[model samples]
Target: MKAFFRGLVRFLLKYYWLVILLTLASAGFSYPRMIHLFKTISTDPIDLLPQDYPSVQTLLKIRDKLKPKKSFGVVLESSDAEAIQRALYDLKARFERLPEVGRALVTKPGYAFFDKHKLLYLELEDLKEIRERVRRKIQQEKLGPLYISFDDEGDKELDFQDLEDKYRKRYGGDQTGSEFYVSPNGRIYAIYVESKKPNLNMAEERAFQDEIRKTAEGVDLKSYAPDMKLYFGGSTRVMEYRALVHDL
Candidate 1:
């Protein structure tokens, strides 16, 4: 039994190191390829959302890249009521003025993203009259779940739930359908709207310039630009989605 035990220990000691070395060698061989795969997976969203969207810099190039279908996103926000109203008017006017703008719509203000520097979030629900007006638009156009809407404020507006309740009672529950994000501070809110065209070469930077201008009409405004999640979800999710697409 002593001899057997000694042999067993010696065999285990000798084979254990060999097993470990093989495991490490295997991992080393796969690690570089795994890292390369990870990097490629991570960079796919940058493909879906070209880096130069807000500017018309890549418009002509992108128009060529997309032969028949071209889509673009517009995100805007305002702290000033007059600016917001002006923004609405400007957007409506621009939609009418631009012959190329086939799909014209606004997002729900409540479904927006704001910066983390904001101090207060006002309750911004439609007034009874305003709700009636929106209702009229919906009924008239038969726009059911078709429209995506947002407000000047995102979820943080609910921080003042009582005030929001008052606004809800005064206005109505369905503010807008568009969904968006609000920063931790009350300084910024973001809402996304989209446009489609057959060929928008050098996309009209002026397309929604009026709307953006309207949002800041006669008010002190700060700009932080915008970010969007159209192809999928977050950065991690995009990697997973790309892997799935690649696998298929």
Candidate 2:
């Protein structure tokens, strides 16, 4: 064992320069290819996955076919709820017109849902007010051939409490009517920004993210609501967030 150890050390000492030379030569030969590969490689880790994998193949297929949408969530803070509401609606309208924006649910989905089923969601007083308004409108119009029908057979009627409970069970969130837009305290507001394209390449995805942030920043919340503060959240929000946080 001692003799073998001595021989091994001497052998290693004698050829150390040759080993170093071979390593340098190998690295020199492969360095350009490594650089090229690095340059061509995608930043997204998903691109690193084997294309032949079943999960990857399925994801690619679904992405190409269905184009699953992604969104960025935003939070706005202000003391004035009315101003926040006005700004929020204006912002939503602007987002709808943008080419890159698929949609902006600036107003809570629950509110819209509740509004569609207002008869079931609204308070008795509110319902009475609505009936009174309808009566007044009819009287004001003074139509000669007005036909009215209160059909109950077609309507699957349920008590307001039962309907409200069902709605709460189905779509329960702070984003529901009276609670939508402004938070319960009337300080915070939420907005959701969706991308126009589901299957986005790296550049397109970055551009979509940029558009959301840019749109938010361009709004000039001060102009819309002087006290309001806006910031973005959600998947792409970190990138878009740079502008909101920095500008403020």
Candidate 3:
């Protein structure tokens, strides 16, 4: 052990200067390129991933590294919930008209169980009052339709509850066709949104997504994803369509 130790130390000492000289030489030659590369990389402005979206980032990282995604937005106005739904119908027509959309289909495929924080099936006997009421709620509370659901195990649920409270406080009378109840036969609520269009532009596709999200207002969404009627599946086809066609 003593002999081995002495030899190792002597060997390192003997080669230390050569090692130092080589390192200096390499650094001198490579340092400029490395600096230039770093500077070029830093030319883009620093963008920090939003801290509040850890769970989303984690889930995505498991599939693919977190990539910066920007969503386009278009806000619409309506006097009340009925008007909003009506607007969605009109938008869908216009959306469908914007090019190759002859075969667009919209229907619930499979719904096992369903539930909502509150299901509203309102028939407005008097439209004026409801209009005024809706305007007040929207302007004062900044409210929109809220859909809440849950899957099995009942995990990640507080967001649904929060939206429920917000919806209740915001809307007023003359609303019917709404009830908040859980389906006794529920086991899974299909809890995912996809683009329905098999071929659509990205801008148009994303617009459809925003419109759907807006329309699902007052719809019940639970914590866990349940495979039930409450789970309205959004088509992912539209999302892929634009990207796919882009390559063509």
Candidate 4:
């Protein structure tokens, strides 16, 4: 063991300079490659998806046709549906004005769908005038299962209770609720937002999220509906959505 240690000490004394020179030369040779590797690295999870996967293929195709859209889901809380709806309308307008936002949908399919489907999501008195208009149209067009003709108005009952019950049974339990913009219980409102293209850079992605949150927070919910509370969700707000999509 002493002889081996003496030999090792003699070898190191002879080769220590050579070893140091080799290591410095190796580092110099690899410095550019190290820099390039870091330059190409991505923090975005979407970059990790396999190129052959169906979602990746679909995403690439979408990218070719249109810029990828980031979705933001807004949850608004208030007991006053009318005031909440009005506030949401104004909030949506404000969101649209932001350069980052592409589109904002406070109510699904707008007033046309609401006019015809009020009994599905809203209380009977929420849209009394529109309901009356829809009722008149139903009478004129003889819509629904019974298809009661205008002539049979006095003779046959035009009750929509069965239809309402069926709609509630079919859709009330779904996550978005039986209604388009409002929840079944009527205390929560949903907004679906589409944002402009996302930047692959981490700093830009952070900026995107901050812009979305700031825009939501800037809305004066108190002026329109004092009880309203705004909350943000969906892909842009939650990065985990990217992982979930990749798993799918």
Candidate 5:
């Protein structure tokens, strides 16, 4: 090993200039190639994993074959119930007519079915209270006929306004109508918008959402509902919704 090192040192000393020139020439030749490789190198973390790994294969399958269909919501909000309802229906119809929209569902179907079966959903305590109210109403009717009063100052007859106030107090007065699409407070409404385009990539999905926003802007929302605000909802905007609310 000592002899080999001595011989190598002598050789390097004899051709040191040639060795330096060769080294410079090699570096000059390889510099551009190295830069190109660096520029084209994959930065994706998934690309670092071996293709044969189970997790990598699963992720690739999800990215290529099992991509989920994207959908979003268009939210309409206002203090005026009538205006909001009218605008919601109009907007829903317009969205449905768009070529990109697969479907725009607003009001839920089967109102009669839910109305008929709503009693089953009431809690035991609530049902008991309702039964008591019914009993009291029945007793009042029965006793009213027997105790006929000659004076006008007797118990006043129940009128529409009285019944309205009674029920309005029993239930919440904030609700706009009996529709399930409107929020409980009657200030917010949502239209579910599904995409018609198949296998939308990220860029295509963003374009679709932009188209929806444009369609909404084209409509004369102020004419339909005063002080009404439109917003985007669903998976895409959910994270940013809080920021939007703060801005509003």
Candidate 6:
């Protein structure tokens, strides 16, 4: 063995340039396969486990049985509440018109039902206070311009504006007057956009997000609010992931 290794070493030293050329040629041939493997690599933790593992089988079963809907959020921001409201509605309408969008909800349908029954959630004392305020408002409207009292009793008449301000202070935290999802200062709104199809393939998911962005570009948000900006969130990150994998 020692004699054979000595002979091999002598031959390699004599043909060093040829050895280097062959090494480079082998790497050149393998480069494409390396690139292909990188692009097709799986980053999922579940994929790291053996396919026959009990946990892996159970997880696969669960995933197959309960696939989640593909959805993303479109956020609208502006200093003007009126602009945000108008743009929110307009954007929602445009998203709904898209063939890729299953539905766009500015506010969930359940919100309307709960809003109608909100008074039922109030306490007895709160209900009584609301009733008294309503009665005073009615009296103040009926009194009209002819009512005058010279008595020293300092009875202040009810002001609807004050009541409205109080109402806003109580229940309008981070929400607009129309009760849409908003930032704490009421300068931003969000619209939930769900895709019409499932997220079965990364390419298809990218296409879905691309279509949404295209639809948004068609609308002039500045027309509704000068400073209004539109953004996307949620599963839209998948687009970036797919782009990175493709570039790999």
Best by lDDT: 6
Q: How high a TM-score does candidate 6 get?
A: 0.61
Evaluate residue 39 in candidate 5 and report its C-alpha lDDT on the 0 to 100 scale. Answer: 40
User: Residue 125 lDDT in model 3?
Assistant: 39
Per-model RMSD to reference:
19.2, 11.1, 22.2, 10.3, 12.1, 6.9
Badly placed stretches (over 4 Å) of model 1 are: 1-10, 42-173, 176-248
C-alpha positional error of residue 217 in candidate 5 after TM-score superposition, expressed in Å: 1.0
> Judged by TM-score, which candidate is best?
6
lDDT of 1 by residue, 142-188 (tens): 65456444644321212345544564466444332113233333223
Q: How does residue 124 of candidate 2 score in lDDT?
A: 82
Error of 2 at 191 (Å): 2.2
- Residues 78-189 of candidate 3: C-alpha lDDT, one tens digit per residue: 2243333333345445545543233222223222222232233223433444565455545444433352223342222223343344444565321211321111222221
Q: What TM-score would each prediction reach against the true structure?
A: 0.25, 0.54, 0.21, 0.53, 0.53, 0.61
Q: Which runs in model 2 stand beyond 4 Å of their true positions? A: 1-46, 108-173, 178-182, 234-248
Clashing residue pairs in candidate 2 are: none
RMSD score of candidate 2 (Å):
11.1
- Give the poorly placed runs of model 4, Cα more than 4 Å off: 1-46, 49-59, 62-67, 110-157, 171-180, 198-205, 241-248
TM-score of 1: 0.25
Q: Runs in model 5 with CA error above 4 Å?
A: 1-69, 109-112, 124-129, 145-180, 197-199, 237-248
True-structure lDDT of candidate 1: 0.44
| Cα lDDT tens digits for candidate 2, 190-224 | 87878887766545666677787788888788876
Model 2 vs. true fold: TM: 0.54
**Deviation (Å) of 127 in candidate 5:** 3.6
What is candidate 6's lDDT per residue for 99-193, written digit by digit as tens? 88899878766777767887786668767877886775566567865545454422465535654566568875435355577777777788888
lDDT of each: 0.44, 0.70, 0.40, 0.68, 0.71, 0.74
* Model 3 Cα shift for residue 17 (angstroms): 56
lDDT of 3 at 59: 52
